[model samples]
Target: MAKTTRFATLIILMALACGCAKRSLVALVPDPDGKSGSISVSNEAGSVAISTPYRATTIESAKQQPTAPENIGKKTLDRMFAEALSIQPARPLHFLLYFENNTTLTSDSVQLLPGIMAAIKERNSTDISIIGHTDTVGSKEYNSELSSNRASTVKKLLIEQGAEADAIRTTSHGKENLLIPTGDNVNEPRNRRVEVVVR
Candidate 1:
């Protein structure tokens, strides 16, 4: 049998036994949050794109062509990658803090800050992404600025709580990305928010 090794977000196969030979595999797996991601694997034979979990390509050797994509069972993966899985880093953490009509966080969202801080501090290593989003009630420029301000507000609070300033990244997606899609000029409380992902 072969074992798994981390390659970016994909899992790569490696020999795990004394007699395991040249065969190797590359599989795409979903994140712990159940969100799917994509990856591509190639060799001298050709290349294949894998976006679905469990889908993989088998490579016979460095010079030989890879086999067509196929499904690999979860049992097979667990057996092969036992050692690697044991040492993998904790999966990322996610939080969504909603805002009201303006950039100010809602009362409920403000209450979530302490829990968020605790999660970040519990990690051995942490990298944070704060993405701001706003409702489609204003001009594109205005909405963009509002989103950015939302993200900055969250970042400022995290920093004040002792989170490393350099470890946090902020982005604004204005009306482009929305939690609740609505027609123009709609006021959606859920659409106005900041999403923080800690990994």
Candidate 2:
């Protein structure tokens, strides 16, 4: 009876040891994502390159979705003005001023003059970037010259309104950077405009 009891006890201990060893072995296998464990198991099967589907949206894809112009317009100009205000005039702010095509600045352009002047006065310094652009009505050279003259005119007006003359820098991009791209002969009223960047 003593021999039989001893044998039974040995069997029980062996079973318990096997169970513990099995549990430990199971634990050693890492989780697929490796949230735990020192060793990471890649889900890839072989050396062959696997192309996974991209899940994130790209900027171009986002742009492909139609959006209201008003929403963007409200955001851009106001944001630009706010950014401009933050900049010092000693570091001139750049601005883009649009004008109607084939039309010279009349009272309408003058109407914005006060606001422009106020903006400059608020800065209390001069340095400015004045760029002019035009529609595709005339030869490129002529258009360039015309745009330059228009910018110069604006510069002169700003000087008259208390802005320092030497502080202004001007350029003309004539028939380039059109606000609206139309046919070669097509004239866009919005394209014939001057852009002032105060940087």
Candidate 3:
């Protein structure tokens, strides 16, 4: 009877250990929009969801999708997947490119040039939105003019690099759409940036 009791206790302990291990490693990820969809895994893993207002069922197939490096947004999407699957989701991970300041584009910016070019190339078949903003360091009118210039500069570069002029559109927020908001006339470098959105 004592041997039987010992065996049952051991089995129970093993079962508890397995349950704890599974709970620690498993993940339940919802669809990006938190709709009626979910992915379950015994271990953490990454996934992707394309969220453009426009719909394209042909693009939904992973096999049909263009390979990475060939597609700039696709490469970023892959990075996002790797990050989401990491053991710690809270750790800083790769995100979209944000170019701040009106000075020359840096080496990092140069590296992103090709990717942007790829996106622009694809934008011919899609609608592209380019929004420009600036740090709160000048008069509203001055900042507005500066932001428009910045957006125009980017659009010019894209055009020079072979993007269709008609496919590209530009808008200036003039420090209105700040990622981080500081009081007026304060220099928040991060706010001075342009965002390119390709559908």
- Using lDDT, give the best candidate's number: 1
Give all candidate RMSDs, comma-separated: 6.6, 21.8, 16.6
Error of 3 at 91 (Å): 24
lDDT of 1 at 6: 40
> For residue 74, what is the lDDT in candidate 3?
28
Report the lDDT of model 2 for residue 156: 86
The all-Cα superposition gives candidate 1 an RMSD in Å to the true structure of 6.6
Model 1 gets an lDDT of 0.82
Candidate 1, residues 127-162, lDDT tens digits: the string is 899999998998999999999999999999998988
- TM-score-based ranking, best first? 1, 2, 3
- Per-residue lDDT tens digits for candidate 2, residues 1-199, read 4543444354346546655332110012223354333322122331112122111111112223221111112232234347754653354455555565543674566688777777777876556778888888878888888898889888888889888889888888888778889766667777878876554
- Candidate lDDT scores, in order, read 0.82, 0.58, 0.55
lDDT of 3 by residue, 29-84 (tens): 33445553432221123233433321111121233332111112323234435766
- Among these predictions, the greatest TM-score belongs to 1
Off by over 4 Å in 2: 1-103
- Give stretches of model 1 more than 4 Å off: 1-21, 25-79
Root-mean-square deviation of Cα positions for candidate 2 versus the true structure, in angstroms: 21.8
